[model samples]
Target chain A: MRLAAIALFALAIISALGACSKPPASERFLQDPQALKRGKGLFIGTCGAYCHSTRKDNRDAPYLFDCEWRHGGSDTEIFNTISTGVSNTRMVGFAGKLPDGEDDIWKIVAFLRASREPCG
Target chain B: MEATVETAVDMGSELALPEIPTHWTNARPIGHSRGPVADADLRAGPSAGQWLLYGGNYENYRLSPLETLNPATAPTLQVAWAFPTGTSGQFEVSPVVYDGIMYASSSYNRLFALDARTGELYWRYDHALPGDLRLCCGPMNRGVGIHGDTVLMATLDAHLLALNRLSGEILWDAEIADYQAGFSATSAPFILKNMAIIGIAGGEYGVRGFFDAYDVATGKRLWRHYTVPAAGEPGVETWAGTSYENSGAPAWTSGAYDAESDTLFWTTGNPSPDWNGDDRAGDNLYSNSLLALDPQTGERKWHFQFTPHDVWDYDGNTQVFLVDIEHEGQPVKAIVQANRNGFFYILDRNTGAFLRATPYVEQLNWASIDATGRPVVNPSAVPLEEPEFRVCPGNMGGMNGAWSGALDPELGLAFIPAIESCQHLQKGISVYADGQPFLGGTPLITDAEEDTAYGHISAIDVATGEVRWRYRDHDPLGAGTLAAVGGIVISGTQDGHAIALNSATGELLWKFRVGGGVRSQPIAFELDGTAYVAIGAGNWTSMAAYQGGTTNIPEGGNLFVFKLPAGS
Candidate 1:
């Protein structure tokens, strides 16, 4: 009975975890092979290697690879941050300047998040 | 206090002379202004007792031919007077004297003509910038250019105005460039013939640099030469693809005019994004290079690249000196520069042939210059997108183009205010955002360990690559050098000390604490037979000051003029 109860508890926790876990926008592009490739190309063409350097020392702007953030790091937050830009910083508003507009910023953010992932 | 006028004929319009006055009302023989100084006339011939040339002469030599302030009596120097600029900011403007009146520009684009002896203001002109003005550096005007009846002042917003020297009224104003797009002017407008030649600043904001000449009398835009070549132009291949659009090769200081060669030898700044070159590939010709151009047509006669494809911020914007030197046992017209890349370079001024390159500082580690004058950059020092690298003679440590440098002909020595320091650089792709600076990488720290950072007045012999003498300081040298006729090298320390050294040996002779740091060049002139040394003691420019870690450099702009006590 105790073993059955333990099993039931484990099943209940697993169910709750499954219900709570919702894959982020960053995860979608980061995990999907086609999406990641397109995002990498878009990021490199538009924002990669610029002031938000992939390199550690040369970054005049904040690094985007990791989860650390000056504004926020959530998927919705990162998207809004990139599209709107932070005040008094070089992180310019790329809402319209990019060829793909806001979509490009999301793609670049996804590529940057991939750098923090295991495969990245 | 306020700027006071002891005596004057109102403004430039009410003045007695159409050009510079021949004499002061108090009757001190004004000898510097005898004739109209043309572009090619490097030695416009100082006949008046007033300070005339920007470098005391057109060659930017900073040498005073006036011998009254001899070293024997230099110790007895006493303050004649001090003219205080009303604001608190950089004072790098070297005063130009005509008759007994002195004309100078202060920080924030303020111009004043004062009594040379009494510190009384004659007239003042203010070129006010817009409130939202974006500038890479502080607004420091390097004095004015005067020719015929007009005084040319280059505004920080990149406008050239011809003002009536007698009344200080604007005769005409010509727009040089749109300042909001990172184009501005701080270097003094150079007057040659009837044209005012000027080079624009703001490489950090990614504007294509150029050499411009305006009509001195009417302020008409004459000829302009873009330093960064466009598509199909001579040096375009050096820049990869469309990167040339934002590639930088700015000129922050005035060039030395070779009257004989009819060439304007100007130096260019580093390319943008400063440290990262993935976008702008190849050697990036003309960035960190010196070009000898025709003043008449703005045509490039010859060019010499100092630090090609520079990942380091070694700007070639420093002044180049034209000197007649013995190269290979022949008297050759050589152009010598105490390069910002920590090397002293001598080039054949006529053909831009590399003559010699020698390290003036002890901290150079990036690359040794080759016989062809190209830098053999260390593979490790090339800032890539990965690991970082340490570099010596970090940007601000080598030499300052804004303060300028001087060459002593008699001593054959170039007094370069250099620093002993290093920095760390990490290179990556930095994009060019409009209305923002184009520093490709992060703005690397130019000064890392201040304890290891000492300054020097590195006196390099231009004729031969020799360290003739060096005067070390606890901090970097603040001001430019003056190769005085009294066999003295007058320079200043960042800690407010104006010092005179034996130019032959760098032996300290006289020193005085002016209470404010001196970042402008020391100037000497005579009244009757008496000699006086004058300099501005408010140095609020420098990266060190801007960083807020430097010493308490006294505020207030005061032009301190000193003369030896009567009969010593």
Candidate 2:
């Protein structure tokens, strides 16, 4: 009877997990191709165009198309950096400026991931 | 407490002549109690011991009648005072001195009203800029304009502000454009007939550039003259599809005003996607061109394009000078510009007829100007997707309009801060998004090419279209040139030298190392019969790429004022 109860409990846990929806759009930003395109537009227009250069060496700001991240490299870390900004640096928080808010920030993250190359 | 310096400086005893009056009144003080800058006062130019206009006068000559700081006294120039802005970026301000106060606008929209003679601050006003700001170049404000009791400034966030001339208090604020859509302004507002005239800067961000005149009293827009023609507009056919809407023809600098002709002469910059002109097919009307407009209505009276369908980003935004010159043995009202496209062009100010175009730089390999004022294109220099083409003047042009050049009407010569540089350019795909750089292709330079770049202060005789002489420098001469009645041309070098050359002969008479690169224009004024000259010394981001890097230069913002010793 104890073994039967354990199996039922395990089954119930699996059923609950299966019923849950997929992760939020922002969490799954890196995997979404459409989101990546939106991020490229945002990144190219804002960050890449002004402060950070998408390609080429510009001492004004870091080049965003390389794997050597200055602040943070992980998906969530970059999002946090973009939303909150690095202090004492020209990199300011774009959370308030971004029209789409969190979604746009996530899109920018996706774009950065797709374009980043292994640093020398 | 206001500190006053006692000195005796006067305009070289010229008033003793019978033609000139011994005692001249400043007429009515329009705005402020002590230092009012009236319309009549500004039109009288800087003759009254005050710098009332950005161009010294509406002619934009940048010439001062003060012979006190002539070539003789130039060598003995010693620092009388120095005012530190405490902010660092590009210190390109050319202060306006009126009554006893100096009004200077520095980087990040900081304006200071100080004792002109003592360099003691009376009041300070700093414009609040947004954290998420878009800027193509450094956040520099070239200078400020004064009229009545108000001083006018155009901010980097694309706003026209009127500050109380007496206390630096906010008088009125007018939004020029949406900064988020990539529009920003850096030029000093040109005060014309009670209107604060300003131009927008965002050629890199695909903005529809324009010059707007605002009612100084109400902060209301009087009229706006769009640089790029929109749909159904007269010049819309020059642009392919809807490209004209965002194609840049930015007027990012102040222009000269002619009270006689009642015409305002303003120049426009390059078209969008600076390096690739395939998308914008026809001659980009008014882009890289001079627009003679009616200041009252903001209507285009006449236009002369320097580089038609400019793919090289040769901006016609260089300083425009209105001079009455003897062209071909006849007195002609001429408009002259040491144009960025490697040429010094002179045209009839009234009719817009091209008189002459002369190449002012060594590496101007792109196009040669024909007799009819059109550029005879060189096919090899055109950008191609597969193979890159080497073009002269690069994207920075032979002369960048960021710094004003001086036109010595007395010498009939135009002193240009000339750059000798070139780069290989290839066409690349650029998709424009709102507030993003619309540079169709980026200018990539090799170390060898960059190392070969240098600059000079070239004096071009407007009459004969001949280069009289070039004061060459190891670094780019990025500072504006100032001419005085004493036959002296003053300019600064990127290597930190405030140099004064003989206006007629290219002779370097005096130079002072101010511990920082000098990128500002030097203005000469007199107080109590004592003559003083002022310039801002600091580094500029625009010259970084041309300089290879700015690590070697000392970086700080300070206004250095020099005057001859008590009895020099």
Candidate 3:
């Protein structure tokens, strides 16, 4: 009986760890304040202010907050689109090229999502 | 003769009474009845008149009636006035001019009314767009439609808006498609009779494409026809599964209207999950096909599939030209298209029967013709679950970019701007989860240069389906073809020049430097027996991502209206 009880405890712990690894429904990784702050810094450094800045005359590329993803929405979808890139469009993939790889793309996506979210 | 004098006096009084420069410009209805002589014989040539319709006319001919300007003398044509758009977005629209006024739409849904003769702004209307509307294509408005006293326009957020021509007031507005599934409107609306027809854009963004018709006066939805077949539709069997419901078959360009036959001829884009045909198979009905529909009832008359189960994104969204041509000694009503898949198709407009299909460009590898007009696509050419496959025409194709061809009535030729290039495309399987699909592809680009014969303006005989003549350009021909009255075939090139060529022989007539590349179609208009040609010049190219280079052209957006000095 004790052995079975220990086995059940182990299984529950493993399942709990798995659940923790996945992002919660309420807590979007993209809306995390730290991730957005880091993302904004990286975006400014890499993409440069010419395209990422919010300006009236800057019609070439949309502002980071206002960038219309031709693909889909959601943090994961935006992250994947930014990482994988689109063909025949201006969005080029940064999969292996970005400094921090997938994590960096996720950060950028988080920053964009946070920026677009209405603040109280 | 008495009637002509009275008409002239009426026209003069009409022009004199309209001191409201802007109101006079936008108020000119679709088919302006009274104006300076617009006939081919009465003017210097057909290049001497104003462009009044979406594709210049309901026929989608892109031909003008005034002809005073020739390419040989284009350098001598003086600029009367220039109206700067002053906005920063790419303007992909062809301005509609009637009487002495011009109507145009900008990228971000800004419509402007300007004086055609003096380049003065009359009125501006802004359709307030939602914040989160994602645009698959760029924020581009193709053009606008004018019917009766109302000017019609389709917005990027999938709304059809009607404005009072004289007052720029929103008469009626109707939302055609939802923005959540990535559906939007970029193509210009076509006005026929009292019905306004429009097609949805968003094939790349994975939206089920459709075309809708609305009542011109009241914004009542008349009919909605799905480009992809639904469950019980005739072509539902082709999809073979539920995948058909989510298929992508956008009609991103304006359709041609045959007033005589009362048929609307339009083309559709490729099916979605763009690169892979795994889920949706069996010739994916209605997508990448030319459809002829009854404009009033929205019923399909006939359809001709160009690229069945299209995997290379070769959309049949080119302008469908309705022409009356003699095929094998019989007077046949036909529709001509310079398909994006590198083929020229001539179909019987009355029926969707294929008359002839010939390759208009050089590098085409997807399929070849047998005894019949059907394209036997090589199974190996189909994009597989791998990384790199060499594909001809790439995504651009021989006649890629945006161009509208002109059909010369007298010469029986269809003037086209064609590119000669190939691409290496790689496709991989992807899942459609969270509205995004995984696409893995690489393109090996070559052969696009100034010295190489990469692009040309060719005139093809519509009846014989043969290349009559071609004029090579240093850069790709970006603008559309315009056949004018004085035997002049006018076209714009990426090298920033508005060129006039002989419609019969493709001889260079005149060339005028427009300061920037002329990607928009050129229009010719006449006022008081004097002829003028107008073209919008700006340094913008849709294929900017494929080719990386600094644009040498000036970065200014302006409408240049040119005319011969006084009495010449």
Candidate 4:
């Protein structure tokens, strides 16, 4: 029992040494270029041009760059808005329609987060 | 004919009939002779000081006969009065004035009757909108149709209500379609002798489109003709598999009714999913086409398709103007329209035969017109599943059907309020459901900054489809036009101005900033020997959202009526 506890303690210390090492599986999708491309296609197809658009600021829908959220701009909040639509607007929730169901929303959030980079 | 009132107090004439006490209560009722004008009277065009038809006589000639406010004196015109509606919703009201009163409608299905001379409120009716109802487009109510003592209104929840002209009470409410299944109504119903007809909206939500005719007295739905055929119908083979069930072909705009022949002319919207037609192959018949139908029996007479298998969402649902212009040195009856597929077509109204198709916009590169007036699509401009396709004159069209343009019969010119834009369209897989958005592809739509898109009002000659003159604006012009007497073409601009241009030459004569984008249709009339022009400056439609958003147009909710200041 003591050895098991010592092993867990060592693993915990290793995780603490590099805080980013214990990231969620969904968080890693932000760096994967292929995953970002797929997420972009999904966003452009499903959400773009309905109310919001991907091009510059020529649409009635507020531009979705640089993190200005009408509800909340956090990663989790975006996931929620994408998973469950924003009320009183044309935005509809995408639950089963996405390629990977609910998991695709996390990829979209990551893709949008990375889009803020200069020429991502 | 001008309005007469007790203005100067009649001090000298004791022979003027003495006022009888309590006389109004016992006044004899005037028979139907002098009641609200009939549809036949409207078809003949309203006299000066009267606006009978929605588009000024079924020709869709939004022109007026009054010319009291001339171009030379228009600069001295000032605001006669300003009427305000409390709601800030979308205002597409093209008001009708008759019997010394003007009628208009606003968003959320509200109607207003105002005194034409003083702009005073007469009556207002608010349709009780249901909470569960949802609209795919912006909430807008085009102007109402008035016939006899009844005013016909098509509601946002897909119901047609006939109300009394004097009071604000509903006479009857006819449910046209089910709102739960993504069906709504926005356009004004065309009022006839004993029946009122209207079309269906929500084409983006996969609603199978149709238009129904209701009995004027009891509000009973007489007949409904579907724009898309059923599985076993004649046009079902055009749609593969079960795609015909959800194929979008909404007839959502006001139609022109020819009372003499009892034939009706209208247009249809795009097919679903909007940007992707891979699932449903073949030419989707009747969707992007001009259809002629019999209003009495609801039978299809004939149809002329503008865009066969329209994957670009260019709806051919604009106004069908019946023009009696020369064709091959012979006077022929023609139906002219600026099609959303980037071609201006003049077709034979009687047989639906194509006469001519000309390009009105400069950046239209998607298709070319053949000798038979059919569009020859370019393969390179067609969108694909992966790579983005750049198409000129995007899905918003070189011109939209939101407010049909005006026609000048004397000048033989059709003023087209046009836009210049391009889009990057891409196709993808779309899921179909009962009451959900069904656009199956992605599109980046805009008046593209890279191409420097702008707006223009081009006057196209009706005989030949050639643009005679062009009036250019900095922003894209998207409102309706009014061609009146004295060689003036009055039109609203994206910069919130009601401008009057010389009809023969494209000279800017008079302009006034109404403090908001004037996307509403303009109308002119005469009252007390003075001519006045009125326009509602509020546009929350897609064009306004696209142009007004970028132009920083102020929020607008007022209706302005202008005339020559006291003594010009």
Clashes of each: 15, 8, 24, 0
Q: What is the lDDT of residue A48 in candidate 2?
A: 40
On lDDT, who's better, 1 or 2?
2
lDDT per residue, candidate 3, B375-448, as tens digits? 78866666643324456665666675366788877788889887665554444333333233222222333343
- Scoring the B chain of model 1 against the true B chain gives a TM-score of 0.91
Give a tens-digit lDDT track for model 2, residues B467-564: 99999987766789889888888888877888999898889999998877888978888877788889998876434554343336756788999877
Docking quality tier of model 2? incorrect
Give the alpha-carbon lDDT of every model. 0.73, 0.79, 0.68, 0.76
Ranking of all predicted structures according to lDDT, beginning with the best and ending with the worst: 2, 4, 1, 3
Docking class of 4: incorrect
Off by over 4 Å in 2: A1-58, A64-67, A73-120, B1-35, B447-449, B546-550
Q: Compose the digit string of candidate 4's lDDT tens values, residues B436-522.
A: 677776666544546466789999998898999999987777778888777788878776788988888878998898877776777
Q: What clash pairs does model 4 have?
A: none
Q: Is the docking of candidate 3 incorrect, acceptable, medium or high quality?
A: incorrect
- Quote each prediction's TM-score: 0.80, 0.84, 0.76, 0.87
Whose DockQ is greatest here? 4
